[model samples]
Target: MSEKRSFLLQKQNDAGKLNQSKLLKAEENARLLVTLQKKKKEVEQLRLQYKLLQAEQSAANKRIDALKQKLAEKARCKEAPRVHPINPPCLETDACLRQTAIAYLKARKQGNASALSRHFAPDCNYQYANNREVPNEMVMNNIRELWEKWPQRSYRLLKVAYRDNHVELIYIYKYADQRNHSIQGYAKEKWETNSAGQIIHWREELHPGTSPAESAGYRLVPLNIK
Candidate 1:
């Protein structure tokens, strides 16, 4: 009977040890499952961050491309040749006439009275707006007075038309008076040049109704004159 009792106690102990081992295994598995879940969450967060970075990079690239296109369009407009409405077929003497006209404008802008006098004939007739015809000397005096009144001035030639010995110029005139009051205007000028390329007759009509925005669209061609 004692041997049987001993055998029964040993069986009971073995069964209890097996139950404890199963419980330890179950706890380990639970810990491993928790660790695997934590790793999975970190990977998902990393994926989300990578996707966000890619979206931002794509947006930046699009903005850069848009800016490049705008710059290219502006460059094209700047490089395009201007076409004048009154542009006609070229003449043999047109180049000389154009040069003289441009030189006269440059001298006027420089406020160089002596240089201006060289382009005019002795009997040159000058008229401004609705004013009466004035002698060349009187015109020079008037120009000097104008220079005194408006110390800062610029002329932007818009168009030039030539017919025979006559040349027409459309220009924008901008000036700031002694008090720093600014004024912008347009002038239409008709000039008759003698065979010696001297200005014999000049008529100018001024229009002060042009808006600044309207004048800004015109491009200025750089002139190199001595």
Candidate 2:
């Protein structure tokens, strides 16, 4: 009876050890599951962040493309051709007159009277319709006043004729005041050059009702003086 009791006690001890081992293994598996869940959450967060970054990068690229297109359009507009072009075969005697006239027009555009005066002779005569002739010195003041009165102006040549050191130009004159009052009129101008190719006589006439037909056979050509 004593031996049997001892053997039963040993069996109970073995069973307890086995149960403890099983419990420890289950606890270790639960810890591994917890660690796996945390790792999965971290991976999910990283995926979401990557998606946001990709979206932002795509938007940035689109904006860059749009800006590039806008700049290209501006460049194209800037590269558009100018209205005036340089042409050859300008008359021998009238070449200086053409250059002087173009320079005068350019000076008017820039409001530079000194530059305009370089094309005129010392004793130049400038006259308008039904008006007394003015000295060359008066030109500077007159042009200054004209530019002051008409702040915005444009002169488009319609026709030109050259003969005997004299040239005639028909042009469209556009003038605008500070009040935005604008008018466009046709005008005829005659210029006579001295031996030194300086303009000595300048005559101008304004024709609001009729256009001059004398230049019908000629196309307005640019001197390309500038």
Candidate 3:
């Protein structure tokens, strides 16, 4: 009977050991599950933070685009030509029309083709001396060529006449080359303005005896001032 009792005690001890191992394994599994859940929470938070960052970046880009558009508008406004407040439209009165003509001459004297072209209509007719009517582009090209030939030149207004939309400008045009060869002559320019005050027709006639070295009584002093 004592031997049987001893065997039973050994079996009971083995069962207790098995039960202990199973409990330890279960605890270890619970710990692993908790760690996995923590890692998942961290990954979710990171994803949410990434989404927020993307949204902020998108908003910033929109703001940047808006600022760029505003800057472009400001630049355009600055570049546009200024209009007189008193005369909202161009060429309202005879005085205003005369001013426009003078402005054209000033732009020509300054050798600013862009400014000069602003005074003309898109399909303006141009004639020089007895030449046939040509497009304004040819006239612009001629002006540029003239400027190249005579870098120093001046057009002094003598008188102005107006008839309806037509304006007659009497001026003394003097020009000199780099070699000091100069010429001066009286010229007449007839300009017709459209309702918009832009020159739609232009004709110029230089009087006789205006050729180089033929201008009467005009003298070029020596460059040496000593």
Candidate 4:
């Protein structure tokens, strides 16, 4: 009976000690949980601070970009300068008919209808291939018609001579047809007596391709066509 009683008492004491140990362990777990909650709160605050810093950085970048754009515009304004054209510009005077022919050629080349009408006299004549004489109106009309037909036409001045009222010129007529062919040419022109030395009648000869004898001639005279 005594031994059994002692065993029973030892079991009861062991059970009480185990209960106390369990209470201490529970308190330790509670303190650790509180520490974890505080750490979580601190982490959330730091994340908020980081997000605010990122937003500030983004706004600062936008402001810097805007400032750079404004600076670029100001630089562009400083770099660019304005220039004005000279009024009543000085005109080039090379020779008598030379200047006139140059003006004529420039106007003719640009297909300036108004310029052509001013220079070309109504009573004009032209002589073409085989001593053929064509009217001045016909020659002028031919030029206008041909230019209208071929817009990309060009003429190269080969040679030119002028003395008092006598004028002569040579040119190679070309179109954009990509043909490596050039015609040797000569023109004899006489200014009209009534029209203040305007070209009235003209005659021309052309050495076709490489032909010295297989040549062509043209004559042109102008009259009032209206």
- TM, every model: 0.50, 0.50, 0.48, 0.39
lDDT of 2 at 191: 76
In model 2, residue pairs whose N, Cα or C atoms come closer than 3 Å (at least 3 residues apart or on different chains), thus clashing, are none
Model 2, runs deviating above 4 Å: 1-97, 128-134, 215-226
What are the Cα lDDT values of the candidates?
0.75, 0.74, 0.73, 0.57
Write candidate 4's Cα lDDT for 1-226 as tens digits: 9999999999999999999999999999999999999999999999999999999999999999999999999999889895432111112212344456566667667887667656655556554423344544565776787566666656555444443334455555555423533333333333332225556556555544532221233121111111
Q: What is candidate 3's lDDT per residue for 159-200, written digit by digit as tens?
A: 555655666666778889999998888887777777676778
**What would the TM-score be for candidate 4 when compared with the true structure?**
0.39
Give the clashing residue pairs of candidate 3, or none.
Answer: none
TM-score preference between candidates 1 and 4, better one: 1
Model 2: per-residue lDDT, tens digit, 99-214? Answer: 65667677877778888787778766777412445667776667788899999988876666665556677777888999999988888887777766667788787888676753
Give stretches of model 1 more than 4 Å off: 1-91, 128-134, 210-226
Q: How close is candidate 2 to the true structure, as a TM-score?
A: 0.50
Instruction: Give the range where candidate 2 is weakest over 10 consecutive residues by summed lDDT.
Output: 84-93
Q: Which candidate leads in lDDT?
A: 1
- Residue-wise C-alpha lDDT for candidate 1, range 113-163, written one tens digit per residue: 999988877767777523455577877887898889888889887666666
Which runs in model 3 stand beyond 4 Å of their true positions?
A: 1-92, 128-134, 208-226
Looking at model 1, which ten-residue stretch has the lowest summed lDDT? 211-220
